[model samples]
Target: MFISDAMAQAAGAAGGENVLMQFLPFILIIAVFYFLMIRPQQKRVKEHKNMVAALRRGDNVITSGGIVAKVSKVIDDNEIELEIASGVKVKVIKSTISTVVGKPAPANDTADKK
Candidate 1:
């Protein structure tokens, strides 16, 4: 006979090494994403939460809306009173505060004031 039978390729063992090797790139990608993106984002969120939690009176902050104000009073868990201008104030959500620009440093009585 001139035609020969086509033999099938041999299957790999079921030890799972081949499966792991096939998925190694995906696992690495996920790990890289976690380290490069997810972990840093979580860290930033934690830092932001801590910063917001530590917010108090006299802390100069910039709102996400680009308004510069001082924390005149922390009204409640979710709201704060901001002194946007002299004798002018406004209420805002706590998380809307973006950056604590100037934290009021404690005054040292021993130092001479010029």
Candidate 2:
């Protein structure tokens, strides 16, 4: 008896449009994050996969665990032998390695043994 039915219907339609506009900024922010942040991280992971697969023996490397060791032996497609110390070696998986250290120098016999 107090409010008109036609006015109430018009107000409901306008409120729905306002609600959708309020959510537009949030959707745009999520799209920006996916392209700028998430996509680059995924690409980096794929490149790291290729790098690990190409590793070979004699390539000095540092592990993700922060242990720097030379590639003493490549055991298989997934495992490798790391020489952390003289006569002290350890087995590490390919994915564990992070960076390749400087390459070893070529051996040259210049000095005479005493």
Candidate 3:
């Protein structure tokens, strides 16, 4: 007398949504993150790698530690010699160079202007 057969039939009729519909919001959130965050970060990393690869002797640079110097020599793939003052040089890791300050005067252009 307490349990009704009509109530049991109604409960069975109400089913949940499909599995894909339940996970659609999560998938959209991940896509948003990739476009807004991860993609741009990867691009910046590529640009920094290209800039570091283009390093050459005589280019003025600033290190990550805020020291200003000129690239006196590129020691190897991962190291460089910086000339901070006249006859004062220090060896630093290439990645420690934060920015290329000013490029050296091009020899051919200077000679032509003279």
- Most accurate candidate by TM-score: 1
The 10-residue segment with the lowest total lDDT in model 3 = 11-20
Off by over 4 Å in 2: 1-12, 15-22, 104-114
* Residue pairs clashing, model 2: none
Ranking by lDDT: 1, 3, 2
lDDT of each: 0.91, 0.88, 0.91
CA lDDT of 4 in candidate 3? 85
lDDT string for model 3 (2-113, tens) is 4788888877766566667888999999999999999999998888888888999999999999999999999999999999999999999998888999998776866778
Off by over 4 Å in 3: 1-17, 109-114
Clashes of each: 0, 0, 0
Query: What's the lDDT for residue 56 in model 1?
Result: 99
Model 1 bad stretches (over 4 Å): 1-7, 12-15, 112-114
